[model samples]
Target: MQKIISASNFADIMGVSKATLQKWETNGAFVPSIDPAGRKFFYVEKLLGVPEISDMVQSSWEEEMQVNPLRSYTSIELFAGAGGLALGLEKAGFSHILLNEIDHDACVTLQYNRPEWRVVEQDVRTISFKQFNGKVDFLSGGFPCQAFSYAGKQGGFNDTRGTLFFELARAVKEIQPKVFMGENVKGLAAHDGGRTLETIRNTIAELGYTLIEPRVLKAIFYQVPQKRERLILVAIRNDIADKVQFKWPDPYHRIMTLRDAFFKGELYDTDVPPSEGQTYPLKKQKVMELVPMGGYWRDLPLDVQKEYMGGSFELEGGKTGMARRLSLDEPSLTLTCAPAQKQTERCHPTETRPLTVREYARIQTFPDEWKFAGTLSSQYKQIGNAVPVNLAYAVGRSLIRLFNDIESL
Candidate 1:
């Protein structure tokens, strides 16, 4: 039987106020067991089922996704920014034969960290992947989302020309990999009123690959300590699609907190290593100091809110990100390239400053020793653009499972 904890004790453990816990209970976010004496209590095992708690604990951070038993399987990655996906795949036991990216800084970072990876710094359209036909196991990319020129016809491979996604599909056709994975911002599902994604699905079908129902994986549910989400599209060679079955990774049992990312804890053996970071102007720092942990622009005095928010104060909608300080008690907000940007502030929980570069990397689940190369701004961009390493690991493991099933047949 699982141990039972009192409501107050559970609240303390979660670092949330009792009122907040009650509110969550009221909303059915969590439920507690009742004792015969009328005391409310919760089972730790049951608490793990809560999306916020269970998801974090069971998320991909701690375990290695299953590895392919094959002696060797190669991969080619396109638009491989800062290697978040690549790193996770590597951790899950995939070998990189080639990786292509247009950004010079990202290429430099890749080469700096793993000299073994074949880094092709060039435009995807200009590159020819035909030489690798039937030689690669997987072709993956996080292609940028762009509107397609539908031309009012059934959009297929030809109509997708001029978009980055075309290059991804082109590579899949050229390499003839057993599997291909494409990831993008969640909005891709609804982009252009869903026509764009529908076209992608149809294009993959035309290329003779079986498309799996694409899904949007919320990073938070996958053990990334941020609220980031990505849309994943997978396709398998038609010959073996029926022989293989693919399953998305299970959600973690607990949510990682900001403290888990920064402090010496399960995620890291030691505190974050020292690294360069951007700083706020003196005036901005003073203003931020007044903002408490988990507080945002709304916490500021009326005059301060007006001054800090400028015209945004009068604007409608919840400008929630403004002057937002992360809560140490909870997972951090999704990070952006510019932490101090007014529209998407990610203020440090305790300090009146932006998270350092290493801190940013930690939140993105980058390994501690995985060094980044570039100016501070460039590094921030690299970290911000990376797929959370843990999430990639989960996807990598799933790919391995598919590969194994195919090989066994």
Candidate 2:
């Protein structure tokens, strides 16, 4: 993976001017990430798959235009991983009737945390949601996004049949919640030239719901101290759509930093409590030691940089995460399931080690009291894959407001 090389560095490598590359992006080179100040970053490998779209600019504000929703709302969460979404929604007033997850450890985590809630540890495909049909108010889950089979004409619902999303759609059709939401990586919005999402849209419509255009929500804007982004899709049943207005949650009072997450002051009542974390091997540990807080491989001495990054050093892209250390002032880069991976290193800001279980949870806004089950790696995966608790809480408030309007009408 190329770290985030600058546009100038990339343009030079590609034998093109910066203007020409920007033009390519305008003409559909690939979607890029823009910082708060509008600095853009491109993933060199990902740029190869960028499909041209005349509508590129407009997509940025789509999430901002929509409305967002809900207390006393009965909900079922499918593919629930470690309760990030469920916990937040519960805090906002929705009661969970059932939560289903296939991972045993994740199920344990959920069950251990909330013994009163019904947590079903089973593959979603094997369970029939027909029992809850018309009884649930909200259906929420983060379905794993898989590539659609382009082997035939883009199949809509039927074509989605073997994937996890198919299971999600099946539940939606069976349970028929007043409103349903799904979350996935932001990349899903552009995956496979958008055909996957197109299929999803068609499937939602076929089930008699109005598809709210999905928008990518940046976690940083919602009080999370990590730069994770999730594409959130919400749909309302056609029959009730007109009766309620959905309002997206407003941004948090301020952007949170790793300092807020790791130390006591604002985000937490206390500093990140000491917990188990993974350690780098001696060689990798020594290499990471040279990386200053907030600095990455680029800040390393030239020879050390090359040795540390291996072949990645020769690449134009910075692969910025390599030999990287978090910053106290800025939000941490998006976390990965394993913090110590060479390609996605998330070295602690002042430590030469990977983020600890508690630090990882804090970054994702998980409360100190919440406990994770399973092996250390499994715990990391669950946290890394979650919708940030605070972000979900914000969205949950919007849901409650929407339901308030719906019931009034």
Candidate 3:
């Protein structure tokens, strides 16, 4: 079957620039199949020859969606921001025994949504996990990535001291859950010339767990309408690790777009509800008005581009995020803490303004009913810092499948 995709989406998948894709079409290397709306798209079948792209389009997402835990599985999440991952795990049939966060606003948001949850609001360093030792099935968190000082020869658990990762490792040492997953920005994989990830692997081994091959998952492939990427580190307690294999979740059959996020569609049953959003200054508004949908700073007039980009205009990189307006036909660019910030603008497609709070939530696959607590900026930070709910759900289902296999064994 022929599955159509937009030029930008295809480019992103192919690891080429839109200009490069355009060049290919111009040179007759490959032709795009146009849809009824006169938009260009490529056939999914044609790209199946490429291994990386093939894995994405050939999906078992529907089958994976039916995955359920063999029995009730308990989880304790550290650094739980706004409950995005927690909610996804719950949907995948895991019961949370505890959710910990240091941010007051994020804690309030979690309590507001699920009062029954044991939401612990405090620094993770002060918390004790010994009480839940051997009682939890999973422990998960998105510990902030920090450079480990390789001053000593030992690159084990103690070496990670003073970093947030040390706290996460401490929880694992105490709780000894069957499985634990750590999520972080994709850059974490290559941070500090790969020493950081190496230390993480070594530390997991020291904790008596077998580290699975870590992977970077693209959120767009997991039913989230954003181009965010996260590095996932999953480990199985050594005893259980010997008996079973962990399979990553299948990518969805198709990429969701901002259109699906905003409208009543497969992703959401209702249109994005109105909510507070930031406003651009008069000068900035006028500059953004000239940029077209899916266009960035480069789309502005030559003089405006210089003025808007300032010194960065002469920088070498594409710098595509500046003065950017989202396109309805494509997944949103990864969101940041503030939508109207000059370096990472997320202007609405047709509105000539920043995306509303609800719109930001929608792009991250947050349910319309999941209310965030905080000032407007704090709300945005909580949402922006969160793992996209759908991406987390996909991973959660895979974890459920792993647990089910372990149960059978």
Candidate 4:
């Protein structure tokens, strides 16, 4: 049976504005049927003609999940926060030789969950990966994006010395794994007028690797119930690069929504477990109560909006994130380190309180049994900074396929 989605839901899935859909309808590029209530709806099957949309819905997520590593493959992970990516990659069949993180709480979380993992709690700069040279099959890290001082100068590896990316590149240079991936925020692609990425490309070239064109992977398309995106860069050692081709992971057949997260659905077997969460102050609570589900600051009364937004009220552009109440029917907005902050309020849909720690984890696709460590704030930070687990698993499966191809050759 063909699934039917409202125009707004369709816009959310395709990552386009409602106006664009309207234009497409007028031009006959894409048309929606108007119902008796004057609501426009689109059949999911009809979207197959759109190239980007087809790429996501055409693949079978069930088939992809069946992929398993042909043999034991070893990997090393850097900036391993809360083990979201690590756990997902492990599920995809890669065994970790070392998982490194500098944060005390994050290291504790990793160690607590995976006692067998070699969780190294130290600065990545102080570690030596030379010992793993030519031994490891894969290396990956989500290095925090920082503006390269030597970007556009073509200084290659040595020029990136002080940045966190330098640590990842250093690990790559030292380990020389068959395949390596670097993850970062989606904005990194356009950072400093794209010079930052160009420098990274050159650095990979100097290290004797062939850099594949980087892509921004959306979490929602990979069975994650949040609108998060990560930029991924995968490179293969030049010697093996020509012999094998790396294919990007196919997207899941459907976009997951927040309903799938908190409720007992495809995402979880049980309802969200009770856990500690932040609460709004009395004054803020009153204002938030006025916000309808799926509504933001604009939904508030004029007087309340004036009082709450204060200076931001007068600013240009829609401050959609301000006083935002998440909708149960749609995926959540990209999470921030602090959910209750004035600029990025992540209020519960039915209640006036902020999302709990476990609820936050659910949106990021962390398994319910995966407990976090440290203070409540620390747990939020760890989860917020993580690459969504399902997204990582999809990417990991593709990497495993790349390795399988390399093994056959």
Q: Best by lDDT, which number?
A: 3
Candidate 4 residue spans exceeding 4 A from truth: 19-29, 34-40
TM-score of 2: 0.83
The better-scoring model by TM-score among 2 and 3 is 3
**Model 1 ranges with Cα > 4 A deviation:** 1-68
Alpha-carbon RMSD, each predicted model: 4.6, 8.3, 1.6, 1.7
TM-score of each: 0.88, 0.83, 0.96, 0.96
Whole-model alpha-carbon lDDT for candidate 3 = 0.91
Considering lDDT, where higher is better, how would the candidates rank from best to worst?
Answer: 3, 4, 1, 2
Kindly indicate the candidate among 1 and 2 with the higher lDDT: 1
Clashing pairs in 3: none
What's the CA error at residue 54 for candidate 3, in Å?
3.2
Candidate 1 CA-lDDT value = 0.85
lDDT of 2 by residue, 110-173 (tens): 9999999999998888999998988999999999989876444755788788899989999999
Error of 3 at 6 (Å): 1.7
The clash count for each model shown is 13, 18, 0, 0
lDDT of 3 by residue, 1-409 (tens): 2376677888866667888999999998778988898888887777777665687766787889889787999999999999889998898889998999999999999999999999999999999999999999999999999999776576888889999999999999999999999999999988998999999998999999999999999898889989999999999999999999999998777778899999998898888888999898899899989999899998999999998888998889988888999999889999999898877889999889999999999998889989999899999999999999998999999999999999999
